[model samples]
Target: MALKNVIGIDHAVVMVKDLDKAAENYKRLGFTVSPRGTHSAHMGSGNYTIMFDPDYMELLGVLQPTEHNAPARAYLEKNGEGIERIAFTAVDSAEGAEEIRARGYPPVGPTDFERPVTMPDGTVSAAKFRTFQWPTAEAPGGVRIFACQHKTRETVWIPELMKHANGAKRLKQVLMVAPAPATEAAHLAKMIDRETRNEADGAVVVPSGGDRADFVFLTKDQLGKRYPGVSLAGLPERGGAGLVIVADVVAAEKALGAAGVKSAGGVVVPPADGNGTMLAFVKG
Candidate 1:
């Protein structure tokens, strides 16, 4: 059978110099992050995950300079605390890799990897994943893209871990700024095996078929107009300039107030207050 198209982004990966500080910043923004997870010595990295059902956010950093830590360290140095990767979801990762190969964008894996995830009962279980990864070097704009198949979903998406104080329900869209929206978005769509359509005033919008999310691509000039306060510190490499999410406006307002965040007016956290990642919360 032909593999399924991109089901939507599985997760947005953020690289940080300090996982503790990163988690603390997210907490200040009213998010509930998971416990620290250590990668195998071969991988040489540690992470904190924010679970949102099947979709989650990953904050990764180097544990030490091992084989795996090199990549994370390099990304942190190059990007300086911003989005480093975007993973698309597929029912079968190997199949997803095959589809990418067919799409003219050759992929590296559907490689099997697992980390011991602590269960709600405090028992340890393997959180297995079949991942097809595309390194930033392969992408036109140096943004990492991949397909992920979750083999043990239950072990990762425990119900208790899904709740957040920010009242964030789900990720709605990702705001991206590229030099040329149409050209860059077309390339990305092909990688994801999704369709790209033009939006008003020289922008491209790619709607993920796998889930309720969209990728909005715009020029830096247009992005500035739409979100005045957002800083364009890191452009295409940062990848995720802004993240849109469904959230309770009232709760967001309270949280922003308590955090002394003046940028978020009920539902928006501009880059200034959002760890260089602009955040827009859809009032619901």
Candidate 2:
């Protein structure tokens, strides 16, 4: 069974060297980027969120070296920039931590943090969150995973921020490239107390709860086959590759064309164009 209080995907954490630049690039790609928000001083990081209805994407960058942001810094130095972590929706972080501990994976923290969010109406409020993670070395397929409890959802998920010009509605899949796709998928499924489904093309899928995004594990060769002619140069060998978005493909193609960003076959945005992570848009 899935851990108590742990629901579906909440958001993806895309580590970037420059937060503002990443935000700008995503805006040019037709996303409605949220205003930059700085985290607690000790964390030494800030982020810009691309909001969807129940899930979102976060572009995170370190402002300075700090004990808490060491991993993020290391990742940025090593992998440059791309999807580094994914957060699951936690109904109650404290309880979720306990459940994770019981499942044999020691939890990291039920820590609290807050960031100031500027509302559409010029009002600013603190968006609080409680989060916990599995062990650092326990990342499945080299992608760190965590659980997040949104203490103030309204402040973060402002209505205006969810409307994107590309008609990007929600996450469909999070792609991870691994040497052994089945093994990695099974590892993640066990970690989340979920089941894995095999695909005909030899990929493996771990479905998150409800209509949330599924984690898709594929071999590097499979990834290449999936998006022919797209460059995967900066992508880590055994880590996150990209995101598949449920969107209006026609609208997305038009938006990219208008911005002068060419997509492979009018569907797949290459990593070079996506700030080190690939993006694929498909009809829901």
Best by lDDT: 2
Instruction: Judge candidate 1 at residue 270 and give its lDDT.
Output: 61
Off by over 4 Å in 1: 1-5, 230-238, 258-266
Each prediction's Cα lDDT score? Answer: 0.72, 0.89
Give per-residue CA lDDT, model 2, range 1-284, as digits (tens): 87769888999998998889899999999999999999999999999999987899999999988999998888877888888999999999999999989989999999999999999889889999999998888889888999999999999888999999888989989999999999999999989999999998899999977778999999989988877766777788888999988888888988877433334444777777787788898877
**Which predicted model would earn the best TM-score?**
2
lDDT (10s digit) by residue, model 1, range 61-178? 8877886456557766776776666777877777777777876667777677778888878888878878877644665344577777888888778788888877887777777777
Using alpha carbons, what is the TM-score of model 1? 0.89
Clashes of 1: 1
**Candidate 1 residue pairs in clash (backbone atoms < 3 Å):** 7-210
TM-score (C-alpha, index-matched) for candidate 2: 0.96
